[model samples]
Target: MMYKHFRHGDLLKQWAEQAEARIAPRIREIEKRVEFHQWRLLEAYRQTGVSEQHLSSSTGYGYDDMGREALEEIVARVFGAEAALLRPHITSGTHAIAACLFGVLRPGEELLYITGPPYDTLTQVIGEEQDGTGSLADYGIGYQAVDLTPEGKVDWPAVQKAIRPQTRCIAIQRSRGYSERASFSVEAIGEMVEKVRRLCPDAIVFVDNCYGEFVEDQEPSHVGADLIAGSLIKNPGGGLAKSGGYIVGRKKWVDRAASRLIAPGILAEGGATYGYLRDFYQGFFLAPHVVGEALKGALFASAVLEAAGFETTPRYDEPRTDLIQLIRLQDPKRLIAFCQGIQAASPVDARFLPEPSPMPGYEDPVIMAAGTFVQGASIELSADGPLRPPYLAYLQGGLTAAHVKIGVLTALDRMLTHSPSESAKLER
Candidate 1:
């Protein structure tokens, strides 16, 4: 109490005394909470170890064969799907969404993506201007995306207005992968889905459920999504899975969606059977722990960067409802440097990209972000190219508190080295 009144060295004794008085009792509960999850995760890890054994020895069936089956079970059980299909053949979360779109929405029919300003890939996949023969337009699919506003949210009126009679599906990309501002909560999305259903019950509601799986035990599937999509090696797999794609919900939609997998039959590329039985299992096992750790990373990144006089989105430790954290640097060069700073801390990275340069195929020059997810974009990392103006950079992902702290430190250190006083000035 005296320490509260005066500022001096003996204050340390009073501070320690008060801290013990305040925290001693809480320690047991905190330890129990932490240990309970830790042990559960350890058990999950053990399960993963066993699964790895089976995964390696299992042959003739090959990687795809085992992975798809495991994933199907994981999706059904973990995500609460009526029927689930896992395809190791599909590339990423976006690929899974496209498959669902192509499978459910017929060519010449209208399809609406309610999630505005989704990943850049969505534009390419749905637009006719780029990606040559790959656009949804090439296949005769009429696609429209309703972008969010300056408040970083969907234009609900616009979403309602965009619906057409031919609309087969309304896609809601729940991924905050590229966005630093905000994302839809499962309940919020559920509200939107319910409203959309009121408008058109037949139209499927598809959510890009990446960076979203297992962050909370109950996912959108629980809230009644027609279909939810994500990648295996991301949050679901807990940094343990090698590869796979997920599409779950609405049995009819899933059944129809499978048709697009491996060309409709004969399991062309390892035959579209819920085949990969193991990776899916491992993914579920690691998801809880990995997600918790990833949240910790996000919080820590927010803490450090915000302390460094940099602006951070999601506000860090206050209350994280999601996995990724965005540290916004309005300067484009600072964004690149931030990305490079994070890479310096990654165990797997040898080099990091921090510049917006042209690539072989991309229409715009994007400053590439590398997150060492086994299949890419797990509870991984990201750095987005700015849309315009101040050109903010987004830094996100840390599967563990330690990793998040180190990554943030490395970024801050790198940033310090490039300050105006410090020489090695970044290209503005």
Candidate 2:
């Protein structure tokens, strides 16, 4: 019973009922809509196709530059942002975030991670707590985190207390894809941002929107957030993007981020003009349907896993527009194996894989990859080991129903085989 929480079962049920109540209409329509659009996206993938513009491909930058420019134009118009940037060269979400963070925050000002202590790769980019030696620490800017509520809502009171005169900007994750429990709601974040605006009118509100884009009926910016950052390799990729991330919102932040794109006199539009163009186009084309499917996988995963006698965060069938699903294993070993099992079930080669290691070189080495059909986005069926007091395996996204079913089935099957004791304990 994914719904069973032992002592918290009733509480979980109450929460689920409330969530269902909130999104009843939308959830009701998603299933059929998602199925229809999925077939269309798969057909599109078979056509125009995708490639990393910045990678070591035989097709150089000049190869299809004109076609690429048209795509960027389409992307700029899709989201109501002043400008957009894209890159197939970058491999991960953190790299894109770093490009935006260091580009926007100055050396003298403090940057508050209002919603998070941040994803693991952040330590390398901004420095770590032990010595505070990352970008912010080494560069003289301060770093602070405002923990979320027990339900995973932003602690507004804490945010009020944490902001200082020197606080340059406040950062939070738009989707709690990485969260063990409560994901911050879009409406809640907007309300909180309005509060922050009242406190420090000058401070910027930045959102790291990894798994939340396209899935939400409303975006962080719709709530007046200064900037929203995330990559295309997830939901925004439309199950079609080969690779990329983006930062969109106000002009000041957009231009500043553009200024940070390296090479001194070099232009920012070089890589982005194409990669972003392609990913953005593909994203919208497949977004509604694909994300809906991913949500279904998350829903099914939560329900089935809970039924199998495990404690799941966000309790399956709980109100979630995003695709993330978390199952607590408690034991680190089981957590690692759980992640490994998810990876093994990926469409790509499973043999050349590494165990669910902490993201090497960073404090949190939890391994995860996007499970897509065409080396597609990982929003569906990607799993990672979380570093915490009690380890957990955080899973999210499924581009197709089949992908979701296969990946999740593989994960549960492995749990039954290698981690039977853990499964038995959950059921007990």
Candidate 3:
């Protein structure tokens, strides 16, 4: 409402008001959970006593680095894990996950994705495709997957059948990734852990925890996961961290991931912080509130778009465990227009229009609107989707609920008034 450059300002305002009213109660409940986690995180930091001395880097072996060790302790405490590894060298969520996979599995051992195939970037890592990339398959590891049922729930019988004697680990993606299915909840994940343990007593259960942190009172590790991994620039970074990722879980498993992250001999003893300590600490401190805002935005967007006849996953009133809001536009041109509109509402790149084009590690052309200080930061306002069938747009993150509301409203307006036919013509 502050900016009047977009069309249907009056209609958008009216919808926003109604959407706010509808979601107010849920937002209040979410605030309480946010407060609880914030207190827990603050207590963890307090117990660790993070100081300026601990913030500096230690090169070479990086042995006895107080800040590095303390940060790991704080992260472990927050996630209810025996140990944790938070590092700038860890890179993206994919890298963190790859470390865990490589650290735990060996040649001839299998990695089973019980929650179906993971995000596109992981297809190469899991050896689902050979793209000249070094993957688990390239190293002689094996892979398997069990798709979800039509109702979007885990196919438990199929899972039991799929687990093999050589299965070394069972990977469950907490978030839905790019799928239309709902993200797994902590309670559900806990049940899954029990079932898997009953079937495969010794199989390590690893949860790919990207986009699912700080949104709930309990984490996957708290619910009996052997290992969990996520990106710092996603839910936990609070829009301040430049780049990093974290892995937390059983001490032995985390140790293995650390070994893979650097080297078997060096492990967590190496890898300098490189001046990312202060931002990482502060970003984690502010994460709870930032996550609440993003969750509120997702709920609001779901409410508004579903009412407008678009198919949105996890309806506004439904329980949420992640920040993604998938809107099925069902039209390629509409999807393009929606992304462009979201970019226009961005604070950073408001003037630039997004177009579908080839991006690395993706099968189809993808269009993205990332108006973040840190490139590809999902914790900030951004919208992106693969340009293919189903024509869905994955909308995630907003530093504040107000920012999300404005951007989502602007996108809806553009979708309604903008000519998809004209956009389609341009596609030629």
Per-residue lDDT of candidate 3, residues 1-428 (tens digit): 36375566665666667777888899898999999998999899889887878777666666787888898999999999999999888779999999999999998899998889889888778774444567898877889889999988889999999988999999999998777888999999999999999999999999999999999889999999999999999998899889999999999999899888998978787887877888888898999999999998998998877656677888888899999999998889889989988898898888999999998778899999887889899999899999888999999999999899889878877776788554334323
Candidates ranked by lDDT: 3, 2, 1
When sorted by TM-score, best at the front, the candidate numbers are 3, 1, 2
lDDT of 2 at 31: 71
Model 3 residue pairs with clashes = none
Better of 1 and 2 by lDDT: 2
TM-score of 3: 0.95
State candidate 2's TM-score.
0.78
* Whole-model lDDT per candidate: 0.64, 0.65, 0.88
Q: Report the C-alpha lDDT of model 2 over 107-127, residue by residue, as the tens digit.
A: 778888877677655766767
Name the TM-score of candidate 1: 0.79
Over 4 Å off in model 2, which ranges?
Answer: 1-27, 32-73, 128-134, 262-269, 272-280, 351-354, 364-377, 387-389, 419-428
- Cα error, candidate 2, residue 145 (Å): 1.5
